[model samples]
Target: MAEKTDDKGQTGQEFPGFDPKSVEAYVVKDPQALAMNFARALENLGKAASEWLGPRERGEIGDSVADPMTDLVKTLSKVTEYWISDPKRTLEAQTLLFSSYIGIWTRTLNQFSGQYSGQPVASETDTLPKDKRFADDDWMKNPFFALLRQLYLVTASWADKLVNEAEGLDEHTRHKAAFYVKQVTAALSPANFALTNPEVYRETVASNGANLVAGMKMFAEDIAAGGGDLRLRHTDATKFAIGRNMALTPGKVVAQSEVCEVIQYEPSTETVLKRPLLICPPWINKFYILDLNPQKSFIKWCVDQGHTVFVISWVNPDERHAKKDWESYMREGIDFALTTVEKATGERQVNAIGYCVGGTLLAATLAYHAQKKNSRIASATFLTTQVDFTHAGDLKVFVDEEQIAAMEKQMNAVGYLDGSKMATAFNMLRASELIWPYVVSNYLKGKEPMPFDLLYWNSDSTRMGAANHAYYLRNCYLNNTLSKGEMKLAGKTISLKDIKIPVYNLATREDHIAPPKSVFLGSSLFGGPVDFVLTGSGHIAGVVNPPDKQKYQYWTGGKAEGQYEDWLRGAEENRGSWWPHWHAWAEAKDDERVPARKPGGKALNAIADAPGTYVLERV
Candidate 1:
């Protein structure tokens, strides 16, 4: 890729002094740091051991262990009750399951006798969407293994049906039960077993036990490292440095607060839009998702499109920030950034965009401003954000009273919700895609993970303040108070309906974190003209899509009538990235063109180059 010039027309090849090799070497061989980490690990283990003996912690542990059993028993009872009430329907389901098993067995017998030639049965919603797992193993393709896999899938499907369709259960109860059933069934898949998974067996034989030995070493090292939880390293740490490769957007940090720092990018166009663009990114992770590389950087694209862009790089909170809450985030984070943007750009109104949780915060901030009768926001855009959490998909399974209390206990003990814990929860949502693949590759096959930018960013997580997380989960996820106008922040109860700015919302088709339908429901809450777009691909890939790649198609012309299916049906499919469409929409809302501005302005001076200090802070 060609090197782009900054606002001052200065060409920079790389981050000034980033040395990946030195950083990697220090991380691997730093004796003092290693000793400190080991000491911390021991202390943490000691505390955990003591806590296990305490009454409160014991009760928490007991509840944790008993909750699953309680759910299982409740589901079984519901299923039994339904069967007793409706024998005919119950018999039909049982008969279908039995027939499915018998059919698979018959197919296997016929295949052995050279009488069967059809393909093996597979679930449309199989956890492993990709088929490369068993493609190279002839044994896996054989009728025996195929039959085994088919039986597992059919059984899992039936279990899920039983849980979801059980009578005398509320919708929430059914969803929770179905989620647990799916999780249990996924864990018990034939693919996870050594005898059934031909590929793992092949890998074991080929490595001659070396893979297992290496996996053991990795596991031990992780346990002693004090990071807490097992994190699969997706790339060699020595291969890439943060500012140099991951967050390479050319800009400068113009303003900083306790919560966030604002980065103002160098204008890539001679004439820029009169209204500046400010981005509010999620604090749960680094803000570089929109600025991964030149080819994929949305920030660069916006700069090149003649819009002066400003992005908020959030501080990765630690124990010191444990008391920070939702109000702090709005007042010290988004509100601070908005003020900085207005002062730096000398623009009365600015266009703003938010991603994921940041979008949630942005909506709240806009509402807060509306309550104060402020109108600094010209237009608003939300990317993969959920304002209404009624149907937040599998993540809702973890938002109930018990789970939230458990999470609170964990966070309270540590002062913050450990990023690894959050990462694990997300990985579980797509275990077949994210977690197990890494487990098999790194452990069973003894292979090094590929150095992919996206995966690298995924692994680089940020801790969440205990107070902030508790407030967010309880108010937003648990109570569904944000859309209901009952969420109190900064001593004010803000409502989404009060914000009347024109809105552009984008949702991914396969986003498991923030389901498309959940994101679409935001339209109904916004008291403004809403243009909703549905793009192809999952959460991260969908939002990072650039038009030059021409990879995924997006659908436009959807009116968010609080129904995802209806919106999708009426939407028109358009090829290429939704970035161009967003740019056009943003430009239409912007003022007339003006001479481009530099990174620093008269009021707000530049503190440091972009991908600034806040992003470099390690928790």
Candidate 2:
């Protein structure tokens, strides 16, 4: 018989052909190593406490303490006032919640009594939903625990209804209340507590509470190492090294500037497309994400498909780059990159692609160039990017006037917005998936983190300039000026509508950073034909999906100018990577295939090997 496997991937019984003793033999832990780990953790805790108590870090502590409480107070005041004014409606909501829980218990009881054979309640999304926190735990399957889970879900639903129905609250205020409500509700999940969680309790007992000690040690170490706020090191950092195991694409640094370095990848095909492809990755991360490994590298895939690929490796900005604004990124970064591509490939017109914030900047550059009547770009592609920030997802919660002002002060103090701050915000967006799970595994259960390439990339973050970050938050996010044609760069007002080139847009169905609807809206802004493809998985996984993986599916035939739902209604689902579709579209745009060109020509000579110097700059 086949062995049963739990969610954590541990089999209930050993494989029929394998010896259980062999597995146990390999799973040895040294007491001396554990003692050393403990010692290091203690040292880190003292260092962290000293830093936290310091005058420079005290301001940050104050903001951290104030912001959450401020939002909580506002939410509570509004909720209380609404409840007081509509006691009848509030009571009705409570009644509905009670009814829902009672109905759940009735069904559960029926199943227990063998009267029902229906499946247990599950979340609508295959992935865990934000509010349905108790869905994954097997303990929750027990009749008693199941009822508790149902009660929590019902209460959460009722809270959301109350927050939504609260009259006299502004949209922003309502969103804040809903955000806080979700946080509070999510914390109350059965999975979070050892007493409530069977798995954690089992592990705790099995380890004789050594797991708790290990967890505390790990937590202290991370805190000392300055990643405590984010919590849990998701990847074994010692196992993988950059430019070795990770980011291993072969290329040469053909061009360089203060803000960016253009890496022209080695051609994989003897013949290549006439219009070379230039990739502008977000400055918020290392460019190596696009070229993570041989099998997963999009740049390698593009090259293999007979296209000369070039990627911008952004500088890890410091105080020296503090004065650099969005315009600097445009003029010195994208503009310079275009010149470098032309110089190297001898192609006056090149195809450009951008991911995340890079796509936002690319859109702006296209409009900026259009204003100058410079038609250098043949086509444009956006990967999980947002030009319209009006509905830019939960991230909008951190883009308010007060938040922006506070951010500016913090950045001013530091010269750049620290990568950790950005990492913390992004983690909060999926706290259940990213943050709390790590907290549970690393702290509560005292397990070592599994090595993951993607999580490592996620942790490998980059700083943002004070001026640039401020401008982006205030203009693009706060005012929603980019889509409105109110955003200006180099003395000219920019608009996404002026981007008349053939556009290919990709959005992930489960992306928290760039919602599919928000990404699809960029299609309407473009003056040219738009091909928007919605793929399964979250932001990074959705884009990095290579054909060989065949892990997730994507949908085609979506209209860029229509509502996301309408597009979804008529779209055709395909069972593999979107790379082939993208490559076919790109090839159609180019004139003809020609003899492959080398990395550099006369003006733009190859400076250094691929995955260049700037990528090595870690702050």
Residue-wise C-alpha lDDT for candidate 1, range 328-365, written one tens digit per residue: 99888888887888888788788999999999999999
lDDT tens readout by residue for model 2, 1-619: 3257889988764334322442232232565654565565456556555644553465544444226567678666887788777779778777877777677767676645545433454532232234444545443445445556666666777788888888888888787788878777766777777656656665655554566666766766676566334334887878877888887777789989999999888787889898889999999888788878889988889989998888998899988888899999998899999999988977889999999999999999999998899999889999999999877988887778887887888788768998887887788788778877777778777788888888888888789999999998998889988899999889998877788899999999999999999998877888878998999998899999999999899999846655788889889999999999899999888649898888886667788887778878764
The Cα error of candidate 2 at residue 531, in Å, is 1.9
In candidate 2, the residue pairs with backbone N, CA or C atoms under 3 Å apart (3 or more residues apart, or in different chains) clash, namely 251-610
How many backbone clashes does every candidate have?
Answer: 0, 1
Candidate 1 runs further than 4 Å off: 1-98, 121-140, 222-228
Task: Report residue 332 deviation for candidate 2 (angstroms).
Answer: 1.0
lDDT of each: 0.78, 0.79
Query: In model 1, which residue pairs have backbone atoms overlapping below 3 Å?
Result: none
CA shift of 493, model 2, Å: 1.2
RMSD of each: 14.7, 8.1
Residue-level lDDT for 595 in candidate 2: 89
Give Cα distance to truth, residue 239, candidate 2, Å: 1.7
**Among these predicted structures, which one has the highest TM-score?**
2
